[model samples]
Target: MDINQTTESYLLNAIQNKRLSHTYMFEGDTLETLRRYGMFFALNIFGDTPRNQSLLVEGNHPDFYYLHTDENSIKKEAVGELMHVMNNKPTESEYKVYIIEAFDKLTPQAENSLLKFLEEPPEKTIAILLTIDKSNILPTIHSRAQHVHIKGQSSDRLKELEYLSEADLQTLDVLSLNAQHIKDTGENFTKLRSAAAEFSSKWINGHSLVLLDIKPMLDLCAERRDYSLLLQLIDGYVRQALHSKLKLDIFEPFKEGVKVDNIIGVNHLTNMLDEIEQANKMIQFNVHPMLAFEGMVIISKG
Candidate 1:
């Protein structure tokens, strides 16, 4: 994946501040891309001059070491070899940096062996481990390393769209839609998203005449697809509020935030989703969109 502004700013800040961690775990995207970025970061650490970059690219940097395995797993022997080399002081730069590609492929024995090295890394030594999946790494190793997740192509595109959040992309993902879909239907999506936020906010605030608010949403549904999208958006909002009530980290796309009082329990939120589902199903049966949506609000209120 291409580097986006977030990644660029993050790397720039870290490099400028010299806030280098002893060990870092880079996760996400392809292994090759992570490795390339990992090397780029390592080069920046020493001084990203053209000469330094060339040395690293040509594998001629005395202070920079790269390890990769073609086998199914990285063996203990490979890690032991790394330990031997890391023990020496830097030949050229003030810091010695080593990058291990496919870190998740390290064998359990290798991981255990590496943990000792991480516990007391050689003075002025840094380790950069690249992995596609973090779950395979031991918790002990994870605890000692700072993690950086590289966003994929889709995520990069979503980030470029100023109006959408990761949570919003996830909602579209559930519907088998994507960033392109949002771009094509930007206006319509914005309307539905706004309406959902407003309606859910009023409902959760215990507005006495909140049922009347459905008219605006019903008015927006010019087609069956629009009506279905509206119901899904509202369902998403309520689900977000329910997650918030339970103190879950589930992402809420609405920037204003979702709130739930003590009175509204999980049952209420579940029933609301059910009502939306029923209303959405009505569209397939040729039910009048306004009547069906109005019925949903009334039932949800009751």
Candidate 2:
């Protein structure tokens, strides 16, 4: 299983040209991916010598150190440990390397500490800050690091328009029926999210989705490989609509049926888009997945 070659080529060019930056920010959706990119680059740069692995396991690599919170590991004193290491001369390799994962989780105090370090980092020392949540990152930190983004694919949605112009009576009727159903249901956020997930899942699994259900998922979709997050969100909207519909009388315009509070109109839908965009930004910045995920639920409910 290999990743797309863009990242590999970028790193290869940097290494080959000997133009490695003092810090690199690697962002993506998959943990395994983030880990591999860091480890692979670390090994390629400093892993060849026997001392490399030995120092890594011993937690005293002169050339490389990883700061993270893990099993029996220190809580993320990332900036401090990194600064400490930078103060020392490299005992083993040609360059000092710091690989920091989840940079978005750095507390405010830590971010401040990091900002200072970034302001005047030691020479020949390289740092990589990895995150999926870019939303909450301090502007200073963002400005300090050169960013690299890795986009994944959506394996959920299927071939939606099976023959748009075709006039097969049964098929045409089915599509028309589906289209009308979506318009009839309305704008319920929670219901929409769930319906979208269910519909997409069914479609991808070789089952038919009610066209009404499929429409709203497409109404506001993600561009990259963020289809997973987008679909789950569609589910949230549906449920929200269901809960709110009891008090409101306006539920037309979803084009996909979702229950919504009477107050939830086009403006609410527009607001929801803003919120989701923020959530996606959070993911890109390396905010905790749970933080971003739960935030979506809350936003939909609101």
- Runs of candidate 1 with Cα error greater than 4 angstroms are 154-302
Write one digit per residue (lDDT tens) for candidate 1, span 1-302: 25666876787688798887899998864555576678878887888788898898899998988999788889999999999999999988989999999898898999999999999999999999998667558988899998888744544445545676555666664433334335546657767678777887777666788778788877776555667667777877887888887788656555567767788888888888888899988976889887887787778777
Residue-by-residue lDDT tens digits, candidate 2, 1-302:
25468887788678778888877888764434566677667755674567676676687766787777653222336568678978787777778888887676677787877778888888878888877556668887778777888542211011232333332212222222222122223333234435555553342222333334444554444232233345334434443454344545343223344433344455555555565567667867767544654565456445
Top lDDT hit: 1
After superposition on all C-alphas, the RMSD of every candidate to the true structure, in Å, is 13.1, 14.7
Candidate 1 versus the native: TM-score? 0.53
Q: Which ranges in model 2 have alpha carbons more than 4 Å from their true place? A: 1-3, 47-60, 70-78, 152-193, 197-302
Report every candidate's CA lDDT: 0.77, 0.56
lDDT of 1 at 224: 54
